[model samples]
Target: MKIIILGAGQVGGTLAENLVDEKNDITIVDTNLDPLRHLQDKFDLRVIQGYGSYPRVLRAAGAENADMLVAVTNSDETNMIACQIAYTIFKTPNRIARIRSHDYDCESEQLFSPEAVPVNHLISPETLVTDSIYQLIEYPGALQVVHFAEGKVSLVAVKVYYNGPLVGNALSSLREHIPHIETRVVAIFRQDQPIDPKGETIIEAGDEVFFMVASQHIHMVISEMQMLEKPYKRIMIVGGGHIGARLAYRLEKDYSVKLIERDRERASELAAQLKYTIVFYGDASDQELLSQEHIEQIDVFIAITNDDEANIMSAMLAKRMGAKKVVALIQRRAYLDLVQGSVIDIAISPQQATISALLRYVRNADIVTVSSLRRGDAEAIEAIAHGDQRNSGVVSRDIGAINLPPGTIIGAIVRNNEVIIANRHHRIEPGDHVIMILTDKKCIVDVEKLFQPINLSL
Candidate 1:
């Protein structure tokens, strides 16, 4: 599809780069000449330097031929105007805009619809980031909280601490505390690998936990484990940007939040905007300021400064200084290597996480489901096991019956809602979400073909 993007910031630039690799026709518009030139030099795509809301700018960038127009400028009003302009002038199929205010209601959206200008979707990254932070607050013990199936199954990650509440507990014994969320402690993340947990497996402190359970039952597990999601009495936030400001306000209702900024004017402005929070002007990285603010005893340290290295270093230093939970917002997605837990407790990559979520909405053709590539080697492909597929007479009558290549592990079969993890006795059923962990890049097509042999040539 022909896609036009407004804004040359990290989010837009990352999207253009990622989608360009997928062979999409991408064109970007930004007032900044530097980023426009950078995008042009790095990728084989059109770049226009001007206000995207301007008619000549939109037309010059080929918005008339665009399948989708995405507006994500720093100013919400500019993004909305750009999307509205593209929708009206180009008759674009989709107009996606990034808005700062989460309270934009139908009355506001109607002003930019197809009748006026077709704004198809609106997403506020500020709101999403706030929700993510709220999830962490609700489940302090979990390293990550991912809800799938519209809250049917929730995934939580926990790290074991020495002498912590759950030390030495049997895997089965903990279920008594698990509410009927149909909770399953499926795997243990040990040595950076996911290990299937057995009933006899003892819960050790320092072991990273991955539990899939019903959303309603999360608190039950917490109570049973005897670990409380401690209500943060105090939070220290570095960087007073949109993400930080929103997070501070959202958190201030429950915790005393202090947002520190290096910019005196911006800090003063944000102080007026936010209530129940203290905005201070200071050099956050300066150890003297951190000492003065008493960052060592803060329950949570949030590093959301615009600078990646600053955020990482501040978070690392805070953890070193004995802060309980250190959450850092990393702007650039390319620096994933530096955001590991060794740098911060929670490293939220906004661009990468946003793009990952968007892919689920844009693609899923012929493919039923797809997960991230592991070890950067191959993708795990999941397809259906039909009756005709079973009868094809390559016919060993089961997965073991097939002549398959090495490094192919059939992980699970979803017959109805139940996910059977390598329970080989169960025969493959038609309309099943059959899963295989592939070790090679090209085997994805081969694996898909085996599941849907009638389209073998595909």
Candidate 2:
């Protein structure tokens, strides 16, 4: 597929990198020459330097015959206009835009129609990140929480602790521990290395385990892996930006929430808007302000400021000051890697979240959802099966019979809204939503092809 990505920033660049490897013709557009040159130097794709909304720029970036147009420039207006131009003038088949403003999102139902803005899909980074954080807080102690199959099933990542019941046990023992609930440990990472999970595989302490289970069984499964944390009550958010304000709004009803904003005017606005949250106007990195707010008693401290350095420092300080957990929103790839398991408990990346949202549209076959995990090296895909045994590789085949790529596992299958844990003997029927985990992203094409319908006519 040929894709024209408007914006050379993090989201656009990462999207290009992901698609370029999957044999797609990717062209990135940007007004800045430096980022464009950097992308061209790093990848095997074309880059055009110009205003992404302009017709000349789109033509230069191959928008005329592009399979997809992804407008993810920083400016919401630019992204929306670029998608409109791609549809009105170029008639691009699929048009996606990253819209950040909440005003547009509130009126999206009426605003994004083909007769209006014409965006086929809208990727809201703030919304995605906020949802992700909400999930983490909802299910305490989970490193990552991603839902699939209309929230019937979820894939959760958690670190194995020495005190856990199944820490030193084999993989098969999980059944004995939770006989009533069905779960599958799809992948395991020890010291940053992938481990193939099997019946005899012994789960070790400090290993990051990714498991899939029914949403109701998430708490039980988490408890078996590690000491389940108490429900979060006191929450502090640094940065009254979109993500922070949205998160505070979501959590205020359930948890005691406090929001700190650097800009006094924005802080006052948020204070007026939020009924339950306490808004403070001060620097998030200020020790005095944090101390005054009783940081040590806070259950979760989330720093989501636009500046990566400020977020990192504030989250680290919160951790040192005795916050139970600290989550920082880091955009830079290097900083994300540097602080993953450091003083910061969890580092959320908007780019990764946005990229995950965009990947489903780019994938072949009937892919319902695509989530990037382990820093893009791994992926959890929910694909719908189409065609019968004669025309599809997966349909009418048992779990063990299907030819899956290396480091890939069928975690679960959701058929008719019922969750079924993957078993070797169970047959996959047509229309089943198959949830899979790919430890190696290079095998993505193979997975896509496996789910695709065969051309019986050929």
Candidate 3:
């Protein structure tokens, strides 16, 4: 597949990196020479240094015969225009744009039509990150929560604390703990290293465990791994930016929500916009302000300022000042590695979230959804099995018979609204939504091929 990616920033660069390894022709365009040069040096792909929305630049980046055009430049206007050009001149089959502004997104139904802006897909990083944080808040003890099969099933990551119920238990014992609910431990990470979960494998304290279960039974499954946390009621958000404000607006109705914005004007605007949320004009890192608000009573403190340093410092301060949980939005990879699982209970990455949203379109299969996990090193996918035993590798085959790549596990299968926990004897029928976890992303192509319907005419 040939793909022209507009912008060599984090989203485009990471998307290129993910696709380049899968034998795709990737070309990244950017106005900045430094990131373009860095990407060219780091990967086997072409990079053009020019305005992404310019016609000549798209031609230079091989947009004419490109299978897909992804516009993710910082400027929303640039991204939209680039997609329009790709659709108009190049006749690109798929054009995706990263649209940040809610104004554009609200009108997306009409604005993105072929007769209009011509954007085939819209990737909203802020919305994705906000939804991700909302899921974490919904499930108090989960490190990460991602839904599959239209919310019928879920894959949750949770850290095993010391003295947890399942700390010293074998993987096989999970069934005994929760006999009524069906769940599968798909992958486990110990000290940042992937461990192949087996029946005899013992879950140790501090291990990050990934499990798949029905959405309704998520809380029950989480309880077996660790003591389930009380549902969050008091929420505090730092920053009045897109993600923070969106989060506060979404959570205000259900919980006691407060928003802190350093800029007084933005705070006042948020105060007028949100009905249930309390808006304060102050810096998130202000110790005096945090204490005055009674940070100790706050259930969750989320710092989503544009500045990574400020978010890190504020979240750490809130955690130390007695906030039960701290969630920080950290952009830089270095800062994310430093603070994740330390003082910060959850660190959300906008780049990773956007990449996950873009991958489903890039993958070659009947892929319904894709969720990037373990910071882009792994992925969880929901793919529909197509064709029959003669044409598809997965259809009509038992779970144990399919030749899945190393480190790939089939967690569950959703067929006709019924969630079936994966078993070796279970057969995969056509149209079944197969939920799988790939701990090793290098096997992505292999997995895609498995779900792909073979061209019998060839």
Candidate 4:
């Protein structure tokens, strides 16, 4: 697909890298020449330097022939105008705009029909990242959860703890203890790529893994991972920015929320705006105040301050104080590399995660759970085992039985809360949800072809 992206900053750059890594034909446009040049030098993509909101810029980036047009510049008005123009003039098939403000236009897509601007998708990185963090806090040991097919079955991530119930276990050994729920541990991010392992392959402590299951069984899956879910009742958010305010609004629907803001005026404003939530006007940087607010009794703690360092520190402190779950909204991916083995519960970047969600939408028709684990085209995917009529020979076999696609892996399967690590003999059933962490771009489409008969559910 030929995609035209407007913005050359962190959001655009990350999206460009992920798209190019997927080997998708990409053209990135920006007003500044430096970031575009940096993108051009970094990846094999066409980068255009011009005013992103202008007609010439859109045309320069080949928007007319583009499969998708994405306006993600930092400026919300600029993005809105650019998308309106693109849809009006270029008639781009899919146009997605990034809206930075917390106040969404809260109307149904059908409501704004006929003469107004039509945006195919509106991505709020802050909302996705913050809400994901909120889910972790509410569900405690969720490991990972990606809602797909419009929130039917969510793909959840879990780490096999060295000391927990799954330690020293093999791919085929899980049924000995747990039963009833058919859970699949789709991919194991051990030594980076998804592995097709033998039954005896032990789950080490450091591997980050993903699983696919019915949305209803989410709590059960967390329990199986030996991490209990603490119902998030009393919550505390350390920032009152867009992420913090929006999260508080969502949380106040069910959970009691208390938000701490350093700025007195903003806190007063937030207190007025968020009538349900308790908005505190104070410094969250001070650990003493956190204790006064009953940090120990709090079910969940969210650190979503604008400062990345502050958010990380606040979340760490919350965890140390015995909070069941702590979430940090740190925007930079660089911080993730150094925090290697630390347990901060969940860490998310708004722009990065929003793009992650967008990429999943981009590959929606063919692939499921398209997430960049850390870097590069190597992705964590839950490919529904679609049986193919085109290929007659590759049937009832594991990754080892057939000449598998390059860089493709069959990670795990849920055959009635049973989590089976992928092995050579394991076969993908019609309803089996397969998680693949594949690097080969062609292998992605090819594997989907093999499992085409199975439901490629939304």
Candidate 5:
């Protein structure tokens, strides 16, 4: 695919990096030469140094022949305008824009249409990150939670601890532990390496386990692997940025929420906007403020400030001060590696979350959802199997007989709203939503091909 991306910022750059490896033609446009030059040096893609919204710049980036145009500039208006221009002039088939303003309703025809704004899709990173954190709070103790089939099934990642019930047990023993519930262990990560889970594979204390289960049994299955954490009641958020403010708004109804912001005016604005939340006009890293606010009593402490250093300091302080779980938003890979697994419970990369959203549009298969797991080394995809056995490679094939690529596991199957754990004898039927875990993401194209309908005429 010939793609043109606006803004060489974190989101656009990361999207380009992910797509370039998939053999797509990517051209990134930005006013800043430093980031563009950096991306150019790192990836085999074109870089254009100019205003992304400008017509000449879009043309120079080959928007005329491009298959897709992604507008993700800092300004929401710029992104909207770029999409409009791409539709009007170049007739780009797909136009995706990063719209930050909550006021803009993408679904409203009055706002976006081919005759007007012309954006095919809108992605809000803040909203995505907020939803992610909300899901984590909903299912406590799970490191990652991805819902599939409209929340009927869930793929959860949990880190095993010494006290977990299945910590030292073999994979085969899980059935004995939870005989009533049907769950599948998709993949396990040990020492940052993918381990193909087998019957004899024993789970260690530090291993990260990924599994899929029926939505109704999420909490029950989680309890079998790890001692279920008490439902979080008190939540403290550091920073009043878009992500922090949005998260507080979403979580305040269910949890006791407090927000800390450094800027006095911005803090005042947030306090007025939020009805139930307690807004503090002080620095999140300030020890005095944290103590006065009783940070130690908080059940969850989330640091989502723009400053990576401030977030790290505040999260570490909160954890040491007795916060039960600390989740920090860290963008830099170096800082993320440094903080995660030590003091921070979870370090979220906004870029990774953004990239996951972008993958759904780019994937060749009929993928309803795609999640980058194990830090991009692996992926979990939910695809709808189309056609019957006569034309489909997956439909009507037995699980053990399918020619799936190595390192791929059919974790679970959702047929007619029922969750079926993948087994050797389970036969895949048409219209089934198959949930797969691929540790080797490099073979994603091959896996996609296997799920696609075969051309019988050929």
Candidate 6:
């Protein structure tokens, strides 16, 4: 596949890095020369230094022969225009644009029609990040939460605690602990090393465990691995930007919400727009202001300010001052590496979250959902099976009979809205949505090939 990407920023650079090794011809375009040079030296791809919205720039970047065009520049107008140009002139097969403003209604057909912007896929990083934070708040003890098979199944990651019921027990004991609830432990990470999970494997405290369970059984499975925190009631958010405002509004109904903004006018604007949230006009890193607001009593403190330094400082201060859990939005990957394991309970990169959403479209197979785990070292994919026994590699075969790549495990299958945990004797049929965990991403091509239905002539 040939892909042309606009904007050499964090999201574009990360996307390029993931796709370059997948046997695809990738070309990146950006207005800045420094980032382009950086990408050029690191990856085996073409980089163009020019404005992405211009026809000459697109042509210079080989958009004429491109199979897909991804416009992700910071400006919404620029991205939309680039997509329109790609459709009108280049006739690119796929066009994806990153749009930030909430003004454009995605539900409206006229917004993306060929007569208008013609963007086949629209990605809103802010919306994706906000949804992620909402899921974390919903499940208090989960380090990461992602839905699969239309929300019927979920993949959750939790850190084991000393008090957990199954922390020091064998993996097989889960059945005895909860006889009725169905779940599977897919992967475990201790000290950043992947351990193969088996029936006799023991889960230790401080290990990061990943499991798959029915959406209704998520809380039950989490409790066995970690002590569940009390449901969040008091929430404080720093930064009245799009993500902060949206998250505050979403939580204000169920929890006490307070929003802090450095600018008085923006804070006042947010106060007028929000119905239940209390907007505070002050610096989020100001120790005096945080103490005045009783940060000690806040159940969850989220720092989402645009400035990475401010978010990190504020989250660290809140955690030290007695906030139960602190989440910081760190844009730069370097900053994320520095703060994630040190002070912040969770450090989310907007680009990482956005890249996960984009990967679904890039995959060759009919992938319904894809998520990056272990900071891009692994992935979880959900794909639908098609064709008959003779034509398909997976369909009409027992899971044990199918040849799966190493470091990959079948987690669950969703058939007609029913969740079935994968077992050796279970047979996969046509139209079954199979979810698999891949610890070694290099086997992704082989996995996709296994799910593909090849035409057989009799």
The numbered model that scores best in TM-score is 3
TM-score, candidate 5, is 0.96
Per-candidate local distance difference test: 0.68, 0.93, 0.93, 0.71, 0.89, 0.90
| Tens digit of per-residue lDDT, candidate 5, span 372-425 | 775567888999999888888789999898999999999899999888988979
lDDT of 6 by residue, 143-207 (tens): 89989988999999998988988977999999998889999999998887889999999989889
Local distance difference test, candidate 6: 0.90
Candidate 3 or 4, higher lDDT?
A: 3
**List of clashing residue pairs for candidate 6:** none
Write the residue-wise lDDT of candidate 2 on 1-458 in tens digits: 99999898988988998998899999999989999899899999998889999999998888889999999999999999999898989999999999999999889999999999999999999999999999999999999999999999999999888898888899999999889999999999999999999999999998999999999999999999999899899999999999998999999999999999989899999999999999999997788888999999999999999999999998998899889999999999999989997788899999999999999999998999999997777999999999999999999999999999999999999999999999898899999999999998988999999999999998
- Angstrom error of the Cα, residue 336, model 2: value is 0.7
Stretches of candidate 5 exceeding 4 Å from the true structure: 105-109
**Can you write out model 3's per-residue Cα lDDT over 1-458, one digit (the tens) per residue?**
99999988888989999999999999999989999899999999998999989999999988899999999999999999999898889899999999999889889899999999999899999899999999999999999999999899999999999968998889999999889899999999999999999999999999999999999999999998889899999999999999888899899999999999999899889999999999999988889999999999999999999999999999999999999999999898788888889989889899999999999999999899999997887899999999999999999999999999999999999999999989889999999999999999999999999999889999
Each model's number of backbone clashes?
A: 2, 0, 0, 20, 0, 0
Model 4: per-residue Cα lDDT at residue 312: 85
What would the per-residue lDDT of candidate 1 be over residues 296-393, giving only the tens digit for each residue? 88888888877888888888888877788898877755555456556577777666545544433333223454433311223344556564643442
**Predicted structure 6: clash tally:** 0
Instruction: Give all candidate RMSDs, comma-separated.
Output: 6.6, 1.0, 0.7, 4.7, 1.6, 1.4
The segments of candidate 4 whose C-alpha lies over 4 angstroms from its true place after superposition are 108-114, 190-197, 227-229, 364-369, 374-388, 391-458
Minimal lDDT window, size 10, model 5: 101-110
Candidates 5 and 6 compared by TM-score, better number: 6
Residues forming the 10-long window of minimal summed lDDT in candidate 1: 371-380
